[model samples]
Target: MRSVLVLSALILAGFALSFAVSEYTLRLLNMAVIAAVAVIGLNFAFGYAGLISLGHSAFVGLGAYGLAILTTKADWSPWLAAIPAVAGTGLAAAALGYPLLRLKGHYLALATLGLNVSFSIVASNWIELTGGTNGIAQIPGLTLAGYKLDGEQTFLWFGLAVLALLGLAALAIHASRLGRAMMAVRDDETAAAMTGIDVTGVSVTAFVLSAIYAAIAGCLFAAHVHFVSPDDFNYAHSITFLSMLIVGGEGSVAGAIVGAALLTFLPEWLRVLGEGYLAFFGLMMLAILVFLPTGIAGLLRRWRRPALPPQDTAAGLDGAVSR
Candidate 1:
């Protein structure tokens, strides 16, 4: 099916990029892959369901800390730790969703922002568990059939494989009944309620799904770098994730991935601008926002659309004149 082609194309793209880029760039690409997973999750909450959650990084932190603690303290396998890390984050989201989802608009946004701040504070003070600001280290990396996957190239391969699979899952969700309900609730809550859609339930489901994706990204981060700190998943990171979604085109899955990659490498690309790079970068983003409000994906979509023939246009005008 189309999903298979997408998956294959993504894998092939990663394979091609591996040879075309440097080792350092590969590391950045790996990070982008991890971030793409989280951003795609954000697409569910914000893009599809119109739930503006600003505490997404907190879920990522929970997952990273969860795996770090398990692998370090209990000597559990990274693969085994991921299960609880992801599931626990989802559960936490569900528990928090009902009360939090009650608030609409900026109120909900503030609540989630508060959640991220609170998570950062706890992660910093919880010396025994999260290692305070020092973070957890010496965590083990993944292995496949006795082959170690610790190198940048190897990790990129693994990250790409994970990203492709999750990408497909996100696509599936976008086509499912739940996805439709989420969109309906997003478009108009009152109308959706009138149609018998469980607005609250849909919102909660979207939040939890987003959290699960964040957790998976978190686990990958923990395993990849073998270290994690409160700073790694702070409110700033949540903002960056949101920015990725916006710049990539919020409602589209392809847009999310494209945005994640573009933003991830953009700063590096701008490094040639010297110390003024950030200023220029900000201006560029501003321009993109002003002119292409639909994001890069939207622009690409516009380019891909075929133009009507001149005769067809004239015939359409003639028909309108006759009418």
Candidate 2:
């Protein structure tokens, strides 16, 4: 019952937000939506399955570049290209996860970082096909049937629709047996394996699912921006993606959306802070780390403490600082 209301509220919020925010703001919100999609995908690996994937931007770049190349060079429809591009990214992630997910913590993080670097290198050097440093230009806008979706207002509706569907789909997945397996794997990999959960299969599934979401987000980004370049999908961008997951409260779908929205609009909001705003941003991020260790979602959960009391204390644990 709570889930139904929450979902309904989200659906209503999307439409309500569209009307309330200005076009310029909606454009930024659109970016947040795309990024939220990518981060939500990241949650499956980093948040749910305890995998640290710093190479997510590479998968996102693949989806964007896939559509860009297809629509421009192959003269394919943007919509048509999205299908194979997303599937190919999922397959690539599964293949890559087999070896990478075997590592833990820093090792896994570095490996994924290396993958992201490799992707950017190829994108920059592959001039003939990828336009090299020039990047791909004149990418086609999104269209369905004969109607073109080119304006910010028009795209906002589309963005809202996509977010609503993806949110529901993600929620459904979270309630499934596979979701339970992922939780088990995250909590205790060895125990999950002992309990008949194929650890490797679960890891691969999480990675592939996350990558597919990133791919779709990438497709939408390309169609919206109508341009693609290696610089746009850098390793820094990967870190930002991870940061969004953390700041939004990893493991919480609502946090993903909230974090994306805040981070997306933050820079614009801070434009008044002169050129040193990022320094302030860094300070705030540190403050968040200190106070809201679980991120913004955690902060919100703290606010809702009465309805959903702390799990640890209810289990008869003492409430005290570790140190």
Candidate 3:
């Protein structure tokens, strides 16, 4: 319940702020929300299940391209197209996960990284389907209650609503038995298997769930931008998604949301540095990594928690003696 309220407050705040920002800022904010969805899903894999996936953006691309093809090629409505796009992405993840999850640590990371690279190669070469580097264009926008979500502000309102619902769902998952099982696997796969937990199953489930979220974000991206190129979901974007999770604090839903928004807007805020902004961004990230290994959410938790009272050593000794 507390999690729900906090999520509601954040969504409402973002929705209210949308009306005041410039159109460009609103567009960035909407993108942040979409990224947040992907990052939250990532929490399931890397955060809870100890999976190192560098191919998250491939799933996102699959979703985006799936919807794009369905809407443009098959003449399907955006609403109906998202269904198969998201499901297909999940199925693909599951198929890949069964064989891929066998690898651990950096090996798994490298494999997933290869997966992203492979996706890029296929998306770039398959010009007939993905439009190659040119990407798909003229994709249709969504309609809500008879109104077109073509404008940034309108689209943001819709995006916020989706984020809120998904955030709640993520929080619920975090507190459930499934979530605990995933965490157990993350902490120690051997121990988890000894305790009758299905380690392989949890890992695959986490990967699939993460891919599903990425795909949903991709669908939203397609609907909002009305265009997607291979470049949009390249390996760089997957790194960005992982960075968002790390910066916001992995294993935390709130951290995911905060990280996405902060990183999305950080570039804009540093635009004053001109060409040097990238350097500054790197420095700040380094500082955060060194000082706050747990990320911003962990820092906030520390601040919110009440400090413990000092122990009375002399009184303790006296009490012990009397006892």
Candidate 4:
């Protein structure tokens, strides 16, 4: 199928680009993968269930801090630590998501935003627990069966593998009944409720799922940066994550990756734009919001869908690969 080929080609090019680029650029691409993972998770929250979450980075921070504390303080293996770190964050999200996700629209957004702020506060003040503002540093790299992923280039391969696996897993979720329920809920909560869908349960499920992804991303970020700090997962970073999901297209996996890659590499290209570049950055986001309301992934979907023949009766892609 054309879709499979397109995905395959993009993946091949991603790997090739990794090897072809400078260490510095590859480093940035690594960040793109990590951020993409987080934003992809966010897509489930805001993009799928119509529940806006502005505190996703808090979950990301929890994961990073969990791993950092385990590895640096307890001397746990980096790979092994990631499991508990991610699991703890997921469990926390599930517990909190029940109370938090009950809110909708701006209420949910504000509540989530407050959660992100609270996370920053704790991470900054809990010096002994989280190393305070200085943060936990010298986090170890992932070693698999005696193979160390230390070098930037070497790590790129590992990152690519994780991204690919997660992407496929997320795609599979899109084709399932849960995915359909998410779409139905997003389209109309009252209708969904009338049809026996547990609206609150569905919303919480999406939030928890998104949080798990963010936690994994946080683990990867901690490993990559070799450090974890309060500032790293601050509220600004939360907004950035949301921006990526929106700009990439709220409901598409490809959009999440594309948005991450674009945003990650944007600063490099903006070097030519001088000190005012960030000003341009804000403007660009606004432009995307104003003009391409559906985002890049949405645009691509429209383009691709139009290419399919009308009379053949091939079923349309349901809900844009949804949550």
**Which structure among the candidates has the greatest lDDT?**
3
Give the lowest summed-lDDT range of ten residues in model 4. 314-323
How far in Å is the alpha carbon of 87 misplaced in model 3?
0.3
Residue-wise lDDT of candidate 2 within 193-310, one digit each (tens)?
9999999999899999999999999999999999999998888888888888888888878788878777888888889998898798788788888877789878776776645435
Q: What is candidate 4's TM-score against the reference?
A: 0.92
What does candidate 4's lDDT look like per residue over 1-323, in tens digits?
34345445656777999768888888998899899889878888778777888899999999999989999999998889999998899899989988887688899889999999999999999898998999999999998678899888878888888877777777777667777788889999999999999988888888888999999999999998999989999988888888888788887777887888888888888798898987998998999999888899878878766664444344645344432
Q: Give lDDT: candidate 1, residue 95.
A: 99
Which lDDT value does model 2 have at 221? 94
In the range 177-265, model 1's lDDT, one tens digit per residue, is 99899999999999999999999999999999999999999999999999999999999899889889889988778888888988898
Q: What does candidate 2 score on TM?
A: 0.92
Cα lDDT tens digits, model 3, 14-108, are 99899788999999999999999999999899989989999999999999999999999999999999999999999999999999999999999
User: How close is each model in CA RMSD to the real structure?
Assistant: 4.2, 4.3, 4.3, 3.8
Off by over 4 Å in 2: 1-4, 307-323
The Cα RMSD in angstroms, rounded to one decimal, for candidate 2 relative to the true structure is 4.3
Query: Which residue pairs of candidate 4 clash?
Result: none
lDDT of 4: 0.85
lDDT at position 141, candidate 2 = 97
For candidate 3, give the lDDT: 0.92
